[model samples]
Target chain A: MAIIFSSLNIAFSQNNDQGQLSGNFSVDAQVYKEDLDIGAEVPVEKMGLNSYANFLYTRGNFTAGIRYEGYMNAMLGFDSRYDGVGIPYRFITYRNDNLEITVGNFYEQFGSGLIFRSYEDKSLGIDNAIDGLRIKLNPYKGVYLKGFTGKQRSFFDFGPGIVRGMDGELFINEIFETLNNAKSQFILGGSFVSKYQKDEHVTLNLPENIGAFAGRFTFMRGGFNLSGEYAYKYADPHPDDPSGLYNYNTKFGDVILLNTTYSAKGLGVYLSVKRVDNMSFRSDINATLNDLQINYIPGITKTHTYSLASMYPYASQPNGEIGLQAEVIYNFSKGTALGGKYGTNVSVNFSRVNSLEVKPTANLDRFETEYFAIGDELYFQDFNIKVHKKINSKWKADVSYLNIIYNKDVIQGLAGYGTIYSNVGIVDVTYKLKPRHTLRMEVQALFTKQDHGDWSMGLLEYTIAPKWFINVSDQYNHGNSEKKNHYYNIAAGYKKGANRIQLGYGRQRAGIVCVGGICRNVPASSGFNISITSSF
Target chain B: MKKFIVVILFLSIGISLFSQSKNVPNVHIKNLNGEIVNAPDLFDGESLVILSFWATWCKPCIKELDAYNENIVDWAEETGVKLFAISVDNARSMSRVAPFVNGRGWENLDFYLDANEDFKRAMNVINVPHTLLLDGNGKILWQHTSYAEGDEYELYEAIKEQSAK
Candidate 1:
């Protein structure tokens, strides 16, 4: 790599005391063509890249890091076994005053991660880092502990299963000191993950040590808050299962979650609920899709950054479902009456999902559920609303509305597209035009009569603040009765201080591209792109 | 590839034989009532701080935190500086970040939540309307990563040039 960046640029100009060396870099390339009326395809390395870089190095308490990823032939729905790359991730750590340790690759989450969570999300190309030991402790003064035993990356190699976990938490008023002036507060946690693969199936006889467990809690006071978690696992069946939608059923799985919140001064509210069943904890259980996902099913809806209201999004199925979501927001102060003169927010959201009642037993490979029932098929629903406003000082706006239904045969398993209602609307605006210039506009539509029925989009942007920007967009389907493609794009960008670069030309629309609710499946092309980012 | 060049020449010779450190690296975020909090105890060595690193479906990180919530109370009564904002919003949008920051009233910015980004990978933030500018013992005297529209007046002139040193 160019002699390791000229020996780290000559040890970064003879170093500033040798340790701190922050990191960050990104790349994204594309060049494809060959559009056959939107069924775009053209690979054979017609051009595609996806690079990454991370270098980290601290000092006090010691730290070390490395990450370099490349996917010269893996973009356009990623996963080409990530073509080529190395340095999957590296790490080393050491801490003090309360102990901390790490030994190679990491990323973790326990409490609300359901059972466990190892992270990374280069826009849904997921990382799932976790390669060896990890430890964290505080020993008291509010307690907190963690442990690990990794093996889960599966792309640049690793993932034949061998994961272990542990977690702990507590903070009932920072471990009682007269409850720290108590005003209602508490936290509690617990977790225990497990895995170990090696059953090389040959007539079924699995369960090579699988385990899972969870518990969580939280509660606050002023302005209310709540939290919850639950988990359980044991029977995980796989052997030759690649999204055959799980069927070697040995059952035993579970999940549950809850969330709540409330606010004051200008309103705010939230709610969440989940159920999942047969959790689908992967770590190579014949991993599939955003692979090796050892927990993370959140997605109770409401994550739509509009683009035709995120076109029927709401993955989070994890085998079985049962969801919920709610939101509020408000605001509206500046001179009341739906707040105007620069104060008017709004919000309002809703969500739903279903299916999870289960039935059938008597030794047919296990099947029984009912605890917290709720099923009748209908996997997804949404309702949205937004407002946001600011008039003077150069105008601002953002209107919104959504109402999806989706269930395209249980979320894209597509089969005669069962339910697919839709209804979207948007309108953005900006306009500053001077103080460093700016202008923006957007208008969207999405009504539907069923699969690929109606759609419309538009955008226009211009900026010149801290750097520059340019945008152009289009998206039409105009109630396609057969075919009515029209997905255009034009982009430009520039930024300094931390660097950034962008360029584009496009027409790419093949669906499913999520992050957070995790998803991926971008196909359809006609491109020319470039992106770059940096940090130091 | 030769074990990746001997693991990059043994981590660049153990990063040129280590030695350097500053503030902001205790990582462990969560405020907004979820508690936790411990990112260098929100710097206090003497003043001037400003984190950022946003999310909630980033839109220029809600327009650079709504322009620092419209001038963070005259920049914290003229130079007390503070601004936090964190929020990497994982777990699928982290329960809509406290009703999207109280429906965008932004209540004078302070939110937190790094959900699994672990203080955004211990401050090497990979993207999300970044922004930093510590001082008060935490070092980092200026950082930026994306966000336009008058970039908050050059981050309040780099916090009034580091609070006039």
Candidate 2:
């Protein structure tokens, strides 16, 4: 390592400039000593390391770069495919005259990324880089066209399926000469993506072609702006559906999002709704659990900051679900009764999702019928609300309440488990000391007779200026039918200039980590974690 | 009059070509000192510059950087080379870059940042550590998507060959 660093220094120093060359790298190493078996089934590990690096150089309209990744001992709950090191991306790209081309691994997103999204989430160990060719063309002002054909990455390797897609977008202001000066502007876009994989008498015969398409429209006029997209997909079957009821066929689904915000003076309000079906967009036709993910689903439940409130975060069920979210942000005008001296900011948001009602026909063989009949029953639902108020310059407070209904059987594919209903409440307060110091406290409680039982949580955080912070939190399962479990953690961090270090010791419960709607399971563990970062 | 015509034709062609190139938006990135810097200014215009994002714990990243280090001087002499090593370590583990670099004795790399990932999102960087190559004109030239063992040699050859042209 020392020799490598010296060589790098010499390389950078000597190549001061001919064209540009720069790169960055990082490594995360952890030592884990597993305790007695709890709910976890995987073997306990002693240590693990996850690291990767990227290098790039460009001159003129041409650019070249590559990435290296290694996972010596994969993390718990993560797949082992990433344990090997190799080059995941290698390609040269050029852009000139409104045309851009890339040949190699690339990430892209169309619209809300609901149906077609090729992206990477390093923290969650998710990557779906497409190894192929991509092209973007802007034929005229405001008109954009994009197309790509590639195979998705599976760990250090590529998946068997081939993906091809095309999308077109038209910006109204630029496309319609007459609309350039209009008070209201509009933009529209549409996309279609298809995946092909050969099948050979697997458990079942799956469709070789699976396709998804979406159309989006956005209108902006004064204080009112609305954007929405409708996406649909053909039937796609998986090996998990033993009943063969949810077999791959030409399945139809759509996600409609309508966001309208009125911001005038100091008040704002927004509303959105989405419905999705069989939309678990992934790269590997067979990749499961922290592997080969290609798209994201939007979660309807609020992402709570408190431990207990976050314990049961709703992971979007891609196969079938409808969700709605609404939020209002209102700021009291200065000198108003509720505004106080500095004015007051108030916000409230709520969302819920449920499985589509499907009715199944009897007498038909279980394997021959559909997984769900039309007009059945709801799968899940959640309602939440929050209020935030600043009492004074030194103090601020927020309170929230949530009610949720989760179907453990459907969401987790676990047998013998029924639906769960839970109610959760949280309150947070922050106090300011002088100019650079602050302290925050959070208290939360969750009541449920469903999965995991009732729980309570508390967290405290203290920060001093730009360099130091300390946080402590605890979650206690007080109403469990089995033995009550208490989870606690304490962490502190210090930073000086570009360098920062953090130390943490804690006992944590397993939970789900989700982005957009994709998710990965985090295992329960108790240990010490130290992290150091610097640049220069 | 003929000379004037020729100049006009040349200017028009230059303008047309410039218009054809995609405009890369400028982004603000934090330096090792936590100070913000414009990305484009990192290149001094005299030599070919390579910008890479990496971390100490990443094995492949280490291998790639080490490979480049071995032949970087030769590549530099053959075609003026400059390299910037940007670390995307988040707030929790960002302090280790300098020490790690010192430990590795990488004398040729300068450090940059995407601490809050503002630069990453702007550049649409989805995976790490990813690399981006830029030309002296501050225009993105060629970007190899990812790296393998002998990939650095290929990169060096490309740089050398391009600079010579």
Candidate 3:
């Protein structure tokens, strides 16, 4: 640990004009303790640590970078395959005259990322960067093109497949002078991605080459905007038993997504609808649990901030699902009747997802489903409303309410348990005691008759200007008398410039943790933790 | 480990011996119109630029932006400073950013979307609500991570001081 800190410190302090040396480092370590009351099982090491450092250098039109990651025994929720230390990512790029070329590992996305997106999310323990070559060309003023050929990263190595893709985008307003100042702007884009794997399986034949294509369009006029994408995939078959996400079947896949938004001075409205059927595209047919994924299907649901409200978050089902989401935001003037002195902002959102209605065909490996029909199986539904108001110079508050209908059996892949209906409410208040001192308090309550019954949580945080902060929070499950557990935590941190250090100790509840709709399960545990982050 | 430290030190010392100009990298981002714009080009070399990296799902980010929105009018008029809010929302929640910002009545501020976090990586930012202050020449003057209630005042003071210089 000292060695890591010392190296990072040296890198942070060194600065010169020959070229810019900029990098960032972070270290997160935890010490586990035994607590049988929460069904916590200690690991063999009894400690876990995750650390990463990124060094990026840029000179003229050239940039190079590398990321070093180490997971000492891995964390509770993270995959155990990342148990070693190595430099898993490295890339070099050069840009000039509207042409950019990159070699090594890089992340790329085409259009809305429905059919092809390569990215890295540390929180989700996902990094599917492609290792090969990528090129971007802007031949004309309004035309942009991208092409790449690479292999997906798979935990310290590369997947057993070769992926290639090409994308083109055109901005109509810029292409023709006649539409330069048009109120209605138009943009069109398309992408084609394919993966190649070996055919080494017996008893069943597989198409060694599987390809997916996507097309998207955007229309905008003043305050109204509309965008949509349609994608189709060739027959991709994988053999996995009854326990995997993709069963042993051979079928084509397709998806369509539509979204629209309208906004004015103080009002905004958004609506989105999507349908997905057998669209799970992966570089490796045998990989599971967020491994070697070649495409991304966005979850069309609101991501709640409150702990209880997010207790039963929705995860995108790529195999087959129909989802719709709508939201409205309105702000009243400062002196209006409902706006009070400081005005009020209110937003209402609702989202629902259901399984795709499919009927078996004469072929055992294929099923048929209508494009717009929804299945009877309910996957997840959430309706939430939030209001934010500033009472005075020193007082501000935010209140939110959420009603959720979660199908645990489907979302969490469990059995026996049916749907879990829950209602949650939260109130957060902030008070400025003095010039540089502020305090915030939040109280949340969740009521439900299923699952773990009901839950309540409270948190208090105090901060002093741009330096120090302390917070204490507790979540209590009082609805279950048989096993009432209290998950309490206390932490403090200090921040200066681009550096922050935080230390905490608490009992963690076992549940699904998600970031941007990607999720992973974490086991309950008790531990002391510390994290340090700094960038130069 | 000792050998690794030696190599890193050698590289740092060797690299520090050279010199070059410093300026914001020209990273491509998208405006509300879905057209690509060079992020560094926004700095016109005449006014202070404040770039705030935020996401729709983050709470403190909203609070910080709201605080700035209240006083940005006065600040801009007085010091000729500009504020640009960059949303790092991925595809899952990118569509809501526009509505969320307009709903909060923050239309006065310029908004850009870094859907793939290209600008974020170039700046070496780790978390949302990370604020950076750039001079007229696009050189980074000051930066801070996280936000509290009164942090905006400090930023405003920094702006005043730098503009005076």
Candidate 4:
């Protein structure tokens, strides 16, 4: 080990003509008690720590680096196989001109990460780094091609499967360089990917060849832009349902995104609709959670940052779901009746998702269909409107209302009763007392007859910029069939340069934590918490 | 009926207590190969130990290990440390552990396995590629939840402070 370290130093010094080396490290530790009854099945009752270090030496186009990770006690809601110390990613890749190649662990995403997304989410305990060879070729001005073959990362090991993929994209404006200054700019691309695994079957016959293809086109012309992608996957069967009853055959998923903006003034409007079916593409048909995931499905719902607003976030059902969302933003002219002195911003958004209705036939299975029709009933719906205005030179105000209909039994696979209808209203106000001091207050109320019932919340925040901030909030479920639940939290944070410390004492309710498009169920608890992060 | 009610009450309270959050348990155990040995002893004053939890079948884990093997020497010299690469391979494949490490030529890392999962459970490990950094006194100073290619530089900076301290 000592010899290896010496050699590395010498090599880095020799390669780095400037003789400079840099690295960084971080640690995430959590301590809490577990409630075994109504919470998640698995819980961590002790202090868990996960840490890692990274070192990189770069000189020009060449870059080299390695990382060491140590999981003293892994956190709950994570896979247990991550409790070792080792380097998970290392490589030295160089780029000269338009051709670049890398051999080792690397993360890549293809086209909005719909069909393929190999990345890392530290907090979620997901790292799907591909270990193999990757090559990128730019033969001409507007054409690019990428090819790679590797195995998907599974916990501390690799899945018993291999993946190979190739993608090509052409920029229309670049292809016709003379059209660069044209009124319309366009781009088009296509990609194909396939995964292979040995099949040992006896009862049912399954296709060993599984392939997926996608093509995208985008056009922009003066405040108007449109983009669309059509993706399809071949037939694939799993052993879990050997009868091919719940399997997917010849599945197809497509997304069409249209964006237009007239920034000449102060107003913006965006609308989009997407329909997907049987696209839960995975490397291993049997793998679940942080396993051999081969593709990603985007959730069409808005991500709420507030505690109560995020309570009922929707998770994308990859198998079959139809989503529609439309949003409009308008800013009134300043010093007008609706705008006030600083002007007013108003936004309205509506989104709804429903399950794909399917009718079973005597001779044909459900999986054989390419497009499943929508059911008669709706699965989920949300309509919200928000208004933000600067009331005065030292004061600002925001108000919003949301109406939602959520189906617990269908959406969340939890054993429950009927649908829930909720109406929520929020009012927020902020006052600037001084240059570095500000105070904010929020009041919210939720009225519902199903699930947890009616609720009320209040939050206060005090901030001293570049130094400290404190927040206190409480949520009370005053109306419910069962027991009334009350949740409260008080947190303070201090920041200096690149270092920050946060401490909080609070009682929280059980809910789902969703990042990107993935979701995890987090239980409820009351405890004191502290976290410190610093970088030098 | 009374016993059943008590059980229900206990379960309900337990669920309610942890209904909103999860707890990661902590335990003390030894990383055993063919013999039993305490893990704390491995961290001497000379160098900080980078304990990474991984398995032979996990490709990402292997990628991380291979990455470390390729740059183990440089990391050691830059931060003056060593890596304690432990495998969470169960008893069924425990015998295959040493050979896999040898094949990778991971000489800079001391190979060990927690076949029984006692060490894993004690460490509250929920996933692979989990890592921890322990000071010479065996106290955990810094840690990270996951790994990326450039994350090692951040880890090295953390260790340099502890080593200097």
lDDT of 2 by residue, B57-146 (tens): 354465457557656778777788777776765422243344344334345667786554535643445445455566774444444433
In model 2, the runs with Cα more than 4 Å from the true position are A1-19, A37-44, A202-207, A248-257, A281-284, A289-294, A359-376, A496-499, A532-536, B1-165
| Index of the highest-TM-score prediction | 3
lDDT of 3 by residue, A182-205 (tens): 999999999999999998887777
RMSD of each: 25.8, 13.9, 4.4, 19.3
lDDT tens digits, residue span A1-536, model 2: 54454345434641323224545455666566555533533344566667766766544567677877877777665676777688887777786657879899777767666667676677667788789999988799878788999998888888888888999888788778898788887778899998888876456666788788889887767756677778777656554464654544334555555555454445555566666666666555676654555555656554454566666666777667776766665666457898776555555667766666644556332222233333244566667666556677788777778887777776666778888889989988878775557788889999998787999999998877446789899888988888688788899887543345678887767877654455677788666766654322
Total backbone clashes of candidate 3, pairs 3 or more residues apart or in separate chains: 5
Instruction: Answer with 1 or 4, whichever has the higher DockQ.
Output: 1
| Candidate 3 docking class | acceptable
Provide the TM-score for each candidate, comma-separated: 0.33, 0.72, 0.95, 0.71
| Candidate no. 1 TM-score | 0.33
Backbone atom clashes (below 3 Å) for every candidate: 1, 100, 5, 70
- Please identify which of the two predictions, 1 or 3, would achieve the higher lDDT against the true structure: 3
Q: In model 4, how well does chain A match by TM-score?
A: 0.89
Q: What's the candidate order when arranged by decreasing DockQ? A: 3, 1, 2, 4
Query: Which ten-residue region of model 2 chain A has the weakest summed lDDT?
Result: A363-372
Q: Which pairs of residues collide in model 1? A: A453-A479
Chain B TM-score, structure 1: 0.32
